[model samples]
Target: MTGFAQLLDQLPLRFLLASAGCLAAGLGVWGATALLRRLPGVALQRSTWLLGQATVLACFLVILLPHSERLRLVPPIDVADMAPSRAAAPQGPTARPAVGGAPAAAVPGADPASWLTLVAQAWLLAYLLGFGHAVLRLLLARRMLDSLAATGSRLPCPGQPARAPVVIEVDAPISPMLFGLLKPRLLLPQHLRGFDAAQQQLIVEHELMHWRRRDLQWLSVGIVLQTLLWFNPFMRMLRSSLSWAQELGCDRDVLRSRSPAQRKAYAAALVAQLRLQHATPKTALAFGGVCASTLAARIALIREPSPAHPRRARVVRILAIAALACVFAASLAFQPALARRSAPTATQAPFSCTVMVDAASGEQLAREGHCDERVTPASTFNIPVALMGFDSGILKDARAPVLPFKTGYPSYNASWRADTDPSSWLQNSVLWYAQQVTTGLGAARFHEYVQRFDYGNRDVGGDPGKDNGTTQSWVGSSLRISPLEQVSFLRKVANRDLPLSAHAYDMTTRIMPKRTLANGWEVVGKTGTAPGLGRDGNDDATRQYGWYVGWAKKGQRTVVFARLVLDAKQESAMGGARAREAMLRQLTARLDVL
Candidate 1:
């Protein structure tokens, strides 16, 4: 897979898990609100909605936390490697006709890969459509409000400062409402012109309270979140609840200083405004635009308001905030556990293996998939090839003389077209240069060294007349090695256990690709590629196999790892560079070695 595809594979699952956690926390807070319903102070009751909002914010923070740290807590498992034994029978050949032909019937039902691809694409399309629709609706609402403002006339209200909200009188079928985010204006329908001074004061107080609390800004936040998570039902429910809480909180604040008789007058004004218009513009907050149930609740709250102790209310708010903090911490701490359960079964990415070992103790730290399954060494054999060339005095150093390119030889990559030196050969994976080195050493000496290194199946023999058996034997012939053996070989190289001169080892290290991490650690690695079908070296027609083997060092500690992917279609399969990227991603996530 491409690096971008691999990174995208991880996002959806993580987002879903975090969303689930946030929903659960919201429900828990909603349930707690029920017990607080009878509290005398509205501030204490409003704490529940605040807790819900804080919980959602915390969930997002947890989602953004570095996944590597969490993933490292769980050791890798070989779940894919164990799948063959669970199968009902051996599978038939996977090859199919290239042109128009009858499709093959699935063994059980639908094809899982195709189904997953369709589902992912459909979800993304739905999200984009929903978000676009929401944005358009918001724009429409804003236009309606702007149209009303343009036709109305602004008037000055008594006992208010010049910089206070500018009151606008409009001939529209709408209740008294406040519109605009900054420099807000209150829109008063002509129907409200006949109301008494006391009722007008109560209505103005209610709209101003909404402005003081910046309810419009918070409403915009809610709408944006609702648009982004349009597919999540829990988010919809939470947003509705938050809207109700905002209105109710504003109601309590508006009535805080009024007497019981004045509260009754405020309720009457609310009812009178409702009779004129039942609906409010989406971009504006209306004093009497709430539904029947909310209106009744507001009237009841105004009729029998209860006072609460300031100290007690303060304690309750603190406790609620503390509860939200705890939930946030717990979500982050348990993310690995949640991720483990949500992680796709190993069968999804089949035919891959990973092995990591501690360089100091020579102990296996982790293994996943078929780490012990043997495959061709591919271009990875170049490591030993280079070492043998240096030790035998065939090459003096890393900067040894360049090998002249042969025009008659078949070339696949343009980079291999020109003559190259030993360092460039290893860096660019120049196949021809490796073949020349192998041919110069001859099969006899090469076979002797392969046996001494205990490399793979240790079979160096191949077709006798085919380029002296150098290309076939090492690239795609009988020679084979497992990911486990690759790690062992790399460990030996890191420990200087091979029978090579110190200069040869140093020169080889100097030529290895090195990537430095932010933590000051260094990763040295090599990539290898082979044909999916053995005995076919570097043929583009066949599928491909890829390998990445390397060691990481920091201070006195070191780690050796090998990652491999096999038997995949050429276009979809990980190539040599992609294999190295995959290995680096896995290592950075699973270990502290970067």
Candidate 2:
């Protein structure tokens, strides 16, 4: 899927996580206010505003976090997790290489993760539609507000000085309101123009209090959050609460030091401004928004303002602060998804390395420990030897020019007792077949090929003039290659970037043993095993050295892989075969099975 689609698919998870944050912040602020019923209006107002801010902030946090591919809230499906479609296959290293069938199905919808797609794409599509509609509604409201603002005069109030905020005297029947963002404005209906200067002073002060507190900017934040989280009911609740708190706080601030007679005048002014609250944009922090019920509440509060409860207010403030901290923690903890990278492998082997890469881009697809360390290529070197044999016209086809096994040849594997061809030579790991091919190439030519290919140190001169370079250089001897180099070499071969002949490439690919996975992926590879294959520190024979190298493909895409494992002691299974089996299980879990 495209990056945009992936983001869309993740939206549901992000919204859910944000919702968790909103719930926590609401519980914190709302609960605190409930407990301290008589908390100061301004103090409670700030906390309520924070409650709204915290909800949106949590959503932003979730959106800003980096995407995780491997690890997600939903884990990718594994073959083992699938419902069996047929009889279970035998489990072991000895299983046939190319057995095929859809052994399993998607476990009747148990898994939610997509290998290269998202399960939540549908939810994202719906969310975008809702979000877009909300934004369009807001834009229309803004346009309406701008048009309404244009209908009023931009002159100062009759009695107010020339330097006061620009007063707009509108003939419309709206309440006195605070408007304008860049240049503050006090909006007054024409009916209020005849009020005494003292009453007008109280109205101006109330609107100015909103401007001084930067309430418009806070309102803008609420409008934006409403658009983004259009489906979140808590956001709607928070927005309403924020506006209510702002007005209450402004009223308290306006009448704080005024005499009882002045408070009575302010209450009377609020009653008069309740003419009509229509044509007001949701984005505006209008002082005239109070309905008859809200006006009654405002007048009640004005007649008998909340008494100072210093101790109770302090305790409420502390509780609000603690709630904020809890909200932040909950929001961060509820991130939509997390990366689940392949953990470091725990192995009985003292040393291990595994590396894989994308053939076309050369991007490192997967990795284990650092793959740069070099050691003997062991029997794994036969793959290169076979390629050289084919290129030099020393070897023919997959099943041609059968070469008999020598009496003294290493036949540790009983399967290597008979005459061998390219196919069986690799499958049975016949040492004689590999030596014959290498001996035919000779030392100088073999060394030249290794150097040209940049395979390891390319020092095929043997163990200090042992005159055995052709036979023993890669046999726990001089020649060495790292897992990184092995994967790089294979990637070049797959891309046909190597200097080998087409015939050679074709033959080598044909001869390599491959296993067919249930999902139609073909895993082709070679295994190498030897005793004391290390040159410097790891030369102990009891410590078996193993290597599994090759690639897997499903159509045009391929993944090249190389792995080396050094065990502390000899295992019942040949180290190379065991490594290949274990590696298959690991890759199968990823559904990449190389």
Candidate 3:
């Protein structure tokens, strides 16, 4: 859910970028149209159509493309994280701090992330509603056109029998208009039989030209794009302009070789048809995509067609194509905000890692976020300590050698105050018990075992000269492991590949916290959280890192996973528990059976 919320946060920015692209393309088309007014109408028409489609495509491209990571951070959002109670906001592995006093559980409207999420939801709902409404209009319009065509009588082609389209002479008081995309019907008037055969042929020829060029389909594309970018005013204007271009451009094609006398005759047909009204052409309708605004321009252009400037037209065409390429490239170039840190900052960016690997083959199955950046392993190291104890025979089994909590022992969690065996120790994350096991291993064997395990860096030397490697190396001192390394170690444990006694594998696996999924996959994992000096770690939080590592087994299949999250007290919550919940949610979403 949180991951989804982050994506939602980007919706507004995506729309803004797309809108800017539409504005650019619209301006370019306007300039191209003005320059080509003296040339063939087809040039302006085709350019408008092309640039409009490019704008539509840019809208989608912005959404599908990766966002700009170099965007500047929202400063005010990090201001509240300066409170001493929360330490400095997380810098290395940053997280959004639940609005200072707003509380993580019930984040208030004051928080930007919270409100941004709400805005995104509302925007999506509104967009879907608008799109659905547009679609319904198209469907109803198509139905009406079909009903009108049904009542009209079919007629054979006036002149070109072999190449003629299915002509329908409807009784409806409408002008001759081309209709339908897949099944284009050239609808003519029933009274056309009384007019001059040449006039009739001219009308049929005009609508036929639209059918041959598939202009209706292009108009439909424009309508859909207009719907998608309804919020962008420029898109609406571009669509209107493209509609004019479609009609005028078709005029240019139909009269391409006609002399002045023939062009005048065709212009007269358009002027006369302007008197009658037709059900505004909808989806699949041909020349009905034309408008009143273009009728006057069409007649004037047809009566005195421009002396074709082929050379000038070619130059404009090249420039228009170049502008289109620039628009699309600009859209793709913009990236989502959230850059990797290049230098120290007052706060950190959000950080998380979730990785899964095939236990047997050691092949990565799933990976997300930064998994290679190492951090403190914290209490997740308990799994290794448990194995070493069992292997050394110092720990016999899950229930043996029950040890009582000492008065001086660390017991931050109430559950750790009582006696703990291997099972309860893991269940409660009893830190003291792990220290006891390591202490019993006698420094030498402890280092030897960790080195044998090929664990992170294998430093285990504790902090500087503390001489406390066995007791606190994995605590917050020297032992650091990346999420990837954690997965590697876990794969061996799940596959029983480590050079440990049989009892070590069996006892450690038996004691770790286990959850059996519905598909009979037994998942066992451990959670860990650690605090450190905020200064040296380049993080603001004393409690900065969390880990959840484990493996899942079902019959012959086994998969190991490691998840890590970091925050500077983003909330009053245990990091390990948060990491566990998030990791499990991701696993549940991706895994079909296990």
lDDT of 2 by residue, 1-594 (tens): 122332343445444444454555555545544544454544345565545456555645553444322212232211111112111232223433222211122223333333222323445567689988888888887676567678987764576545456777878787677766676667777777767788888887888888878888777777676667676666676677778778887888888888999889888777666654454567666666766666788788888888767686676767655655655555454434422111111111255666778888898877665354456788788788888989999999999869987789878878888989989987877888888888888877887788777776565645532568788878766566768779878888888887989999999899988998767779989999876523223355666767999988889888888888866555578889878988887668775543
lDDT of 3 by residue, 398-492 (tens): 89889998999998989999999989999988999999999999988998998889786565766543568789888766576767788888887
Model 2's lDDT to the true fold?
Answer: 0.66
User: Which 10 consecutive positions of candidate 1 have the poorest summed lDDT?
Assistant: 77-86
TM-score, cand. 2:
0.51
Who is ahead in TM-score, 1 or 2? 1
| Cα RMSD, model 2 | 17.3
| Model 1 lDDT, residue 488, Cα | 84
> Which one is best on TM-score?
3
Pairs of colliding residues, candidate 3: 67-335, 67-336, 68-335, 68-336, 90-348, 91-348, 94-349, 94-350, 178-286, 180-284
User: Candidate 2: where is the Cα deviation over 4 Å?
Assistant: 1-29, 36-44, 59-119, 157-164, 194-196, 307-315, 330-594
RMSD of each: 18.2, 17.3, 15.3
